[model samples]
Target: MGDFNQSVVLEAIRRSGEGSSRIELAEATGLSAQTVTNITRRLLDDGLIREAGRTINGPGKPRVTLRLVPDSRFAVGVHLDPAVMTFVLLDLSGAVVRRTSAHTPDMEPRRIVEAMAATIDALITGSGVDRTSIAGVGIAAPGPLDAEKGTVIDPPKLRGWNRVPLQAVLAEATGFPVVLEKDTTAAAVGELWMRRASADDSFVFVYLGTGIGAALVREGEAVRGSTRNIGEVGHIIVDPDGPSCTCGSRGCVEVVCTPQAIVAQAAHAGVFPEDQGMSDVDAVEARLTELCDRAADGDALADGVLRQAAAHMSVLTAALTNMLDVDRVVFGGPFWSRLADVYLREIPDRLERASATRAVRSLPVDGTVVGDDVGAVGAGCVVLDSVLSPRASALLLGH
Candidate 1:
C-alpha cells in the first residue's frame, strides 16, 4: 500500500506537469496530508521527485510544489519491427532522452538479438547516462506473444521466430529485466500516457502496420488481456469476399486491411506498371508510399484502391468500436502515416454509417499523437509504467 500510495503521488505530479503542492497531491490522490508529506520526503530523498517553488494559500504557510525528476531513472524501449529495430531512452517522466534506429539485419533471430544488445549498449553509452539509472528494458514486438513465458509464438513476417523466449533472452543479453508487449497495446499505452489530461480516455486503437491489430484503452489504462496479448485482430473478418486468408477464413483483417493487401489491391488495379507487386518489406513500404502519393496527386486508380482499403478498414474499426462501445477510434502503426490522409478522410463517415451507437452518440476518429515512433515511445512508456503507473507499480513491487 505504501508503494501504491507513492505511485499515486508520483503519477499526480507527472500529470500535473508544472508541479503539485503537498495539499494538491493529497487532494488529487486522496491521501492524507501527513502521508503525502512522508511520501514526498522519501521521493525527494530518492531523487525521484524534487520540491520546486512554494505557494502561499491565503494566510497559510507556503506550500512547496513537488515535481518529478525526469532523469531520476531511465528505461530503454525497443520496437522490434520486422524491417527495422528502433531504440529509445526515456527518462522517468516519459520523455525521450535519446533515440536511434537500425535496419534489422538479415541475420537469424539469435544474431539479431546480439545486434539489438549492441545497439542498446551504444545508445546508453552515447547518451552519457549512468548505467545504474536504467530501471529496465521494454520491448514492443509483434503479437501472439507468450507473455507468461516471454515467448514470441510464430509472429507473422518474422522468419525463424517460433516460441522464442524474447524476454529471457534479451534480459540475459542486456543484463536488465525485460518486459515484452504487443506493439499495438504498447502504442495504446503511449497514447494514454500522452493524453492523460483528456476527459474521455477510452478509445479503440486500430494499429496499421506489417499486420492489422487492435488495442483497447479503458478510462485511462491499457486493457492488456488475460494473456497480455489482447489486440490479435488479424483473424477478424472484415470483408467476406475480399481475400482468402491463411487462417482458412475469407477476407480476414490479415488479408484485407494490411499494407501488403492494399499494395496487392493496387497491383491488381494496374496502379503500378507491373502485374505483380513487391513481396519484401522495404519494397512493400515503398509501394505503399507511392500509392498514397499517387492518391494525393489525384490519380483515380490509386485513389480508388485507397478508398476501397479505407472502406475495408472501416468495417474492421466499426466491429471493434461497436463491440467495445468506445466513443472514439485511433489509427496508428508503422504504415499509418502513408494512409492517414485517405483513412482520416474516409473512415469517420464510414464508421459513423456502420456504428451501432450512431443514434445515441457520434464516434470520433483520429490518428495517434505519438507519431512514427509511437511503438518505440510506447515500449519505453511501458517500462516507465512499472515505476510510475499506480497499478503497474503495485504489480511490479507486489503487496
Candidate 2:
C-alpha cells in the first residue's frame, strides 16, 4: 500500500517537471489535499523528491514547489550484445547520469554472466549512488527473448545463451529487481518514453548497429507477435538475387547494410584488411571512426564506403516507409551515430525520390538523440514506467 503511494508521488514529480505545489498534486491526481501532502512528505523523506523554489502563480502568494530529486532513485540499464555490453545509470527523469561499458564477453553463457555481474557491480559502486534506491536493473539483449520469464530464449548470435534466466541471475547477484526485454523492444520503449508523443498510433524504430533491425510500435505498444518476434526487419528480402544473410535470407537489409558488411566491403576493396582488427564489430567501429575522420579529410575510399552503405540503408528505409505507412521513423544505435550524417544526406533524398507516398505526406526520418545507450535506457524505462504506474506496471511486471 505504501509502495503504491510512493510510486504515485514519484510519478507526479516526473509529470510536473518543474515540480508541483501541493495544490497542483491534488488537482492533477484527484487525491485529497491531505493525501497529496502525505505522499509528498513521504517522497521527501525517501529522498526521492525535493522542494525547488516556489510557485508564484498566485499573484503575490507563493506555494512551495516540489519536484523529482533526479538522483534520488537510480536505475541501472544493461545492454548485452555479441560485440559489446553497455551500462547506463539513469536518474528519475530518465536522464543518463553516468555510464560504463565493456566488450561483451563472447564466451560460454556462464562465463559471460559471471563477467557481466562483476562489471555491473563495479559500475554501481563507481557511480556513488545508493544501492537501495536502485529501483531495478533492466537488461536489453538480442532476441528472441522471453520477457515473461526474464530470459533470453534463443539468440542467433549468442552461442549457448539459450533459455538463460538473466533476470533471475542478476537479481540474485544484486538483490534488486531485474527485468529483461528484447533489444528492439527496449529501443521502442526508449523511443516512446523520450518522444512523449501520445497521438501517433503507428511508428517504427529502426536500429542500425553492427546489424540492422527494427521495433514496430503500433497503437502505443511494441508489436509483439505470436512468438514476440514481430519486427525482424533485417531479414526482409529487398533483393532476391543479392547476397545471402546469416539468417538464411538473400539480399536482406542486414546482409548489405550492417557495419560488418560495410567493413567487409572496405576490406575487400583493400581500404582495411581482414586481420586489421576490423573483423569484429567493435574493432570495425573503431576503424570506421578513423575512416569517418579520414573521409572528413577527403579520403576517397572511406567516403565511397559510407556512401554505398548509406545507399543500401536508404533502400531499406524506403521499403519500410512504403510498407508500414509509419507516421514517424526513428533511427538509432551506435552505427547510426556515424551513419546519421550520411543517411540524412542521402536517405531522405532517396525516400523523397523513391517513396510511394512522397506525393501524399512528409516522411519524417530522424536519428535518436539517445545513441548507443538507446537499448539500455529503454530497458531502464521499462522498469521505471512500471514503478510509476502500478496497474500498468503490474501488468507488464507480472506483479
lDDT per residue for candidate 1 within 1-399, as digits (tens), equals: 888898889889999999999998888888999999999999999999988888888887988888889989999999998888999999987888999999889627898899899999999999999999999999999978988998998888788898889999999999998999999999998888777745347899998888888899987888998998898888888889978899999999888888888888888888876655467888888899999999999999999999999999999999999999996999888888889999999999999999999999999899989888889989999989888888843557535
lDDT of 2 by residue, 6-125 (tens): 676667668666788988888876778898888888778877788889767857679999988777777888888888888888877889888888887774787777877898788889
Q: Worst 10-residue stretch by lDDT in candidate 2?
A: 390-399
lDDT of each: 0.89, 0.77
Model 1, residue 118: C-alpha shift (Å):
1.0
lDDT of 2 at 52: 89
C-alpha TM-score for every candidate: 0.96, 0.85
lDDT score for residue 148 of model 1: 90
**Shift of residue 308 alpha carbon in model 1, Å:** 1.0
